[model samples]
Target chain A: MSPKVSQEHMEQRRAEILKAAEKVFIEYGYERATMKHIMDAANVSRGGLYQYFSNKEAMFETILEEGLSLELDETLEMLKENATSYWDMLMKTIFGEGGEPDDEMDPLAPAKLEFFIIGRNDEHRRAYGKTRYNNGLSIYAHIIEDGQRSGEFSKKFDHEIIARSIIAFIDGLAVEDAMLSREDLRIKEQSVLFVEYLKMALGISEHSTDGK
Target chain B: MSPKVSQEHMEQRRAEILKAAEKVFIEYGYERATMKHIMDAANVSRGGLYQYFSNKEAMFETILEEGLSLELDETLEMLKENATSYWDMLMKTIFGEGGEPDDEMDPLAPAKLEFFIIGRNDEHRRAYGKTRYNNGLSIYAHIIEDGQRSGEFSKKFDHEIIARSIIAFIDGLAVEDAMLSREDLRIKEQSVLFVEYLKMALGISEHSTDGK
Candidate 1:
């Protein structure tokens, strides 16, 4: 008789597979990347890979879901601890860990675009995309709401609308980044301009230098 | 003997083919759309279609180029003739002929997104996309510059950055529209809010009602 695998061990194995799959997706994009690539990348047998994910879409979806949830949890935890200013919280949430715009875009952006745009017609994908959009929307909305409550942000515009606009700007940049060169995108300039827009919309003073 | 076609007649025939091809692309999107579909839709022989456009990509590019140029020409003519207010010009240009936000979105948006995002890795396609992006960018930038010159828009922010943000918002919305239902997007509400953002950024008065 073989020894049984522990539940904790299974979870660890699943996490390892997801990390490998993400790298494959980033390199090959959504359409070209295949199960075989993931298998090789993860160094797992066919049965082991299949045991964790039924198909490529499932694996991709799991990666996105897990990453988003993890980020959201960390953000909420940060807020609970009052460890950062509202401005820094907003910037970091939108622009990544540095909380400042730069030339580098998320490497997974192209694959994410392909997955959602190409699978748009599929009922399952459409439903998944909707949930993902809402989850993304709420992350920004929650921050703006907190800022507004604390009088750090103006209530001139609805918090949800402001949040949605932020998502639109970021999503738009991702779409452009997928097609245009970094130089053409002028990512830093655009981000700085958008930061100005956010400041104007949120009533943050231009001279406020605390967050930087 | 085959009749010799006049140059004007040939141009008209090409225009008809492009119109039909546009319909086919909207129906099937970029990847699934085929040259045969365009041939059938345009009621042209295979040889005739080939004589005009070498491939589906060329045909699609021609359609986009023609559409954008036509719109640009019309806009420039209106500006030269001083036919409308700066605010009206900006609104009509961004939100279509109605000049107000509504539930409707561009029907060709998904196809356009697919074309740009999928072909991003191709050298020739990348070149075309960059030109198209710059052309699109200028439309908004020119209007904002005019507004600032006329003292209608503020000069606090760079006109180019604001213009870039507008393009980003529209492109981002198109991406979202491809995957989400119309209701989920809250199109009109988002547009109204964006208009407010624009007004604040440009220093347009909240009570200005002449353009509406």
Candidate 2:
């Protein structure tokens, strides 16, 4: 009889493969990066990789879904704690800690943009992209809604509108970051400047002393 | 003897080919798009097409350069006239007049993004992308600096920083716009909302009461 692979072992193997797939995707991008590359990078057989993900789209969806869910869970936990101020929490959620808005491009930045832009023409990919974008927007809008209810944020602008703006600003910066030099893009500095714009738009009375 | 084509006729034919190339690029995107597609769309022989442009890159560069120059000249003329409010002129320059922010995706949006993101991996393309980005940034930055100097806009934030943020926001919105439905993205309304954010950041005192 063949040895039964435990569920935990399968999960571990899946995670390991995903880590490798991420690397492959980042290096070669969506269109050019093939399953052969993933197999080589992950050190998995064709049968093994196929068992986990039928194709590149499935693999990419799983990767993005996993990353987003993890992020959402963390943000949700932060919301429940309610220890941090709304603005601080929002900034942390968006930019993360110890992020200095420097010139270092997210290694996966090119892949991420390539995936969506190329996906534009594909119906299946477009549907997945839309669902993912809406999911992200909801998380952000919820934070703003919470702030407004607590009177920490101004009621001047719609929470959903403000939330979408955040997405736009970040995405726009990423587009520029992908194309321009760090010196020219000045992402970190631009992000700092964007935070100030956020403060004004959200009608936050005072600026946080942190994030500098 | 072969008939001589005048320089004007040659220039006109080149322009015609570019227009068709734009359509082909929009349909197939940058990577998948082929010179044959452009030739078929333009109804020119491959030889004829090659006479004007050595490759897809040269064709794309010519198209983009023409667009930018036309836009820059119009904007410079606006600055000279100085009739419009700085904010209005900036918005017009960035979004264009009569742009309704509807669901009609910029047909070129995907190709434009694909070109730059893929360019991230190619050194020659990367260098060209950076130069193009800086040129665009300077146009916007110049508008803001002019505003600050003229006392038409407040200097609350660095003009360059503000300019970069505008690029970031627009690019970010385009990223989302390319992926999501117009209704889901809320681009038109969000753009109007973002103008409010811009006002707050720039310290523009009164709302324009336009673009409603």
DockQ of each: 0.71, 0.77
Give the RMSD in angstroms, all C-alphas superposed, for model 1.
3.2
- State in Å the error of residue A186, model 1: 2.4
Please identify model 2 stretches exceeding 4 Å from their true place. A1-5, A97-106, A207-212, B1-5, B82-85, B97-106, B207-212
Model 2 CAPRI rating: medium
Candidate 1 CAPRI-style tier: medium
Candidate 1: lDDT of A54?
100
Instruction: Give the TM-score, chain B only, in order for the candidates.
Output: 0.88, 0.87
TM-score, candidate 1, first chain: 0.87
> Of the true interface contacts, what fraction does each candidate have?
0.78, 0.97
Q: Using alpha carbons, what is the TM-score of model 2?
A: 0.89
The residue pairs found clashing in candidate 2 are A101-A188, A171-B172, A172-B171, A172-B172
TM-score of chain B of 1: 0.88
Number of the top-ranking candidate, with TM-score as the measure:
2
Which pairs clash inside model 1?
none
DockQ of 2: 0.77
